[model samples]
Target chain A: MSSALPHLLVLGGARSGKSRFAQGRAEVLTGKLVYLATAQAFDDEMRQRIELHRADRSPRWSTVEAPLDLAEAITAYSTPETVVLVDCLTLWASNLMLAERDTATATEGLARSLSTARGPVILVANEVGLGIVPDNALARRFRDVAGRINQEMAAVVEEAVIMYAGLPLTLKSKG
Target chain B: MSSALPHLLVLGGARSGKSRFAQGRAEVLTGKLVYLATAQAFDDEMRQRIELHRADRSPRWSTVEAPLDLAEAITAYSTPETVVLVDCLTLWASNLMLAERDTATATEGLARSLSTARGPVILVANEVGLGIVPDNALARRFRDVAGRINQEMAAVVEEAVIMYAGLPLTLKSKG
Candidate 1:
């Protein structure tokens, strides 16, 4: 039986191997691989981290940088013969909030895009609400947004998995 | 039909409601409730936090502050007629590390104590490894140790749960 689903939401904490798990799921599909990156390299450390991620992908995979306008990027890249992997919604949410964009509108747009996407779509998001209540308002707001987005995505996705210590625990699955 | 377990390990991120869930679990047990707090009040903020936690518990519940000698405290307080709730091992781990106490030994001792404890014991720990790798060595080490201790606790506990968005997902259960 194939483990791939038309739409999959992979949730985990940082270094929870969510991206790697998403990549592995995408690799199982028989189609062109498209990586939609939401992270922006604003510092040297980030630049190096991004570079490492880029280096890990096979040359056959095409990359799309979508710090914002994630829905549009998904619409532009998704095809019946293409597997689109959005390697995180948490960063996208942060970007939208930082840009002062209405998150509800953005989230709705992304949801609509996912509903209409032509091929398999794998979305990754960090599980940020599992830690202690952040001491700052900004961090708390970020956590709330992230948690809300994860729930929204989980509701729409055909499959949902939580990664723990590099292991995947299926939270939901399509029959 | 009962959700409470004799030895439950509750793991979650900040504000993920792990502590609340643990408290609820403890409340359901039919015994004298005892709270074993591992957090240290090194500053005014922490003192306030401790006070708040203390205020949240029922006046009938006895509270024990054990920052370093957790195993000894657990041994001393746990009895057949008492339900001991340890509201976090992560802080205890930090305390042990900061005090230059041998973590491996302390962890082993704690495990032994849990194994032999007479009453029901509930542990709460932060799932710290689900995020991006910390930039500094100290943070990275803390994350590593926290993860290891969580795993160790999960192994010995009768039940293991990961709390997210105030919901508990059981990872392990007594068979």
Candidate 2:
């Protein structure tokens, strides 16, 4: 099921406009749009925001919840005639931690899935390791996990970029 | 004491190689290099590490401790024959908060100083806002201050880059 289409990995800090930029990139491509959401609504406000976001992308896209098991979701939802956009791996990494799933193994699986993706797959993630080291062990661990995921995913993707203040800084573009 | 040389802004996360990259950029330019250090050694281990870092840059560079009053330090140290490199603004911001200095006003002063720098000035700062929002109010405030500083510096500098894993991703390069 592997295809030659490029897979993109977009990494950025909070409010860096990574998700919107990624969606715009996905929209410009040919095929049915499939959005793989890895974020979970933890409260009523979050749920409302999520619902509003889904509504915003509703008519032009179909949303698939994959807070966990993202690799499987990518493998199942991607097709030659589809454009799959995964609007974040940071939360997914957290979910893996909470579920006691080994992030290193999961990252390897995700990379493999991306390698065999039948369509153009765009992944968005928060670059959370840039801030000061956290005081808590859990946050520090999460930072390490998230950073490791980004470095690994970035290596696998055909293109990678860091978004800042709504600007794209290309890290790599496989020619 | 303003010169026409373009100042550069280098931003990145921890271990993202921003300082080394900025140093390399500064070393490539013609000048007497001066390093403005903003970090303080609280413990003996940190003292040893700071000493090691200083020794690593010795023979070719002079170091000045500017834990606070960074704008004043830049103004005092910069000259047409010098290339001043501020290893980081993240620590500087923290130092300001610890001392109860007005970060916004200090930032304005820094920007003004950079604009009228007597020679080439290369600023290194952590892109700390890219990660998960900090849980502590103080950490959150620090993140916001650092982010604001970066945004302002990015706009002022003629060259701006985000270093990642020792690689430079150019955000803005003046034409």
Candidate 3:
């Protein structure tokens, strides 16, 4: 982790093509491609979603499931020869809530890991706070957690983008 | 109606400071400020929200309640000496749905009004599709409607921006 590479944070709403855009960026970089997926199949809907995402990726990428311990996954998988793409932080935030883990600690750990990452790391997150407030307490809490995570990761990364209808809007460009 | 000034579309999530930013822009323009408010007080919470928003503006802004017939209101209020600010369109979209109005026709009417408006226009809207799929069908339909309205308004406007925590990211710039 001596030589730190610039990290990128990709954010968008549902079906905004953020994951595809991040994958395209990762494919253009030179390294062993690694995908650290944070989604767990708790139901049939989620299972189907996971399979669809898996099918969307090419054979050049190896997958790792890190539903709760995402920070540790990043720390372990990041290498000078590897390019790790964490295909979302939103689900990871929800997973933390479901598992009753401390999110602040986890968020800090994740940010710290990115600061010393040996290879280029690309993170994807859903921008969930742009809509009307949810009726349920849990959903609102999830939105706050997800949004805070996005902000922290964006501050840690060298590049940040928000996607709309497959269009990338530069939020924080690496100078 | 002729001599149309360039229109602006401001988009953001809840508490993203879109309203304040749009108001600042309108205050800088030279004209009598007109606020086309689309929000209706259906309950105590909504009534309080409306009052708070009303208190946010100065006496320079004359408010017009246009919960449904926004296009007609724009046609009546826009003039060479006026700067019109439509506080929001998401609620207008909902109002259209609740009133059983044809959204496609309404959207077209709005677009046409902007084409030949006689004053500078600033429109605000919520970006509601960035979260997880709502569990209910009506909410899903609303997301689609609101997203479509935003996309259309964005295409028609000379300036388009998305607000995040009071920071504006330019989607399109007036040339």
DockQ of each: 0.16, 0.26, 0.21
Clashes of 1: 15
Which runs of model 2 end up more than 4 angstroms from their true locations? A1-5, A130-135, A164-167, B1-10, B15-125, B129-160, B164-167, B171-175
TM-score of chain B of each: 0.95, 0.93, 0.96
How badly does each model clash, as a count of residue pairs?
15, 2, 1
Residue pairs with backbone atoms closer than 3 Å in model 2 (clashes): A13-B130, A128-B131
Steric clash pairs (candidate 3): A130-B13
Candidate 1, residues A21-47: lDDT per residue as tens digits? 999988877879999999999999999
Ranking by lDDT: 3, 1, 2
Worst 10-residue stretch by lDDT in candidate 2 chain B? B1-10
**lDDT, model 1:** 0.84
Looking at candidate 3, what TM-score does chain B attain? 0.96
Off by over 4 Å in 3: A1-10, A15-126, A129-160, A164-167, A171-175, B1-5
Residue A88 Cα positional deviation in candidate 1, in Å, after optimal superposition: 9.6
Q: Output DockQ, candidate 2.
A: 0.26
Recovered fraction of real interface contacts per model: 0.24, 0.42, 0.35
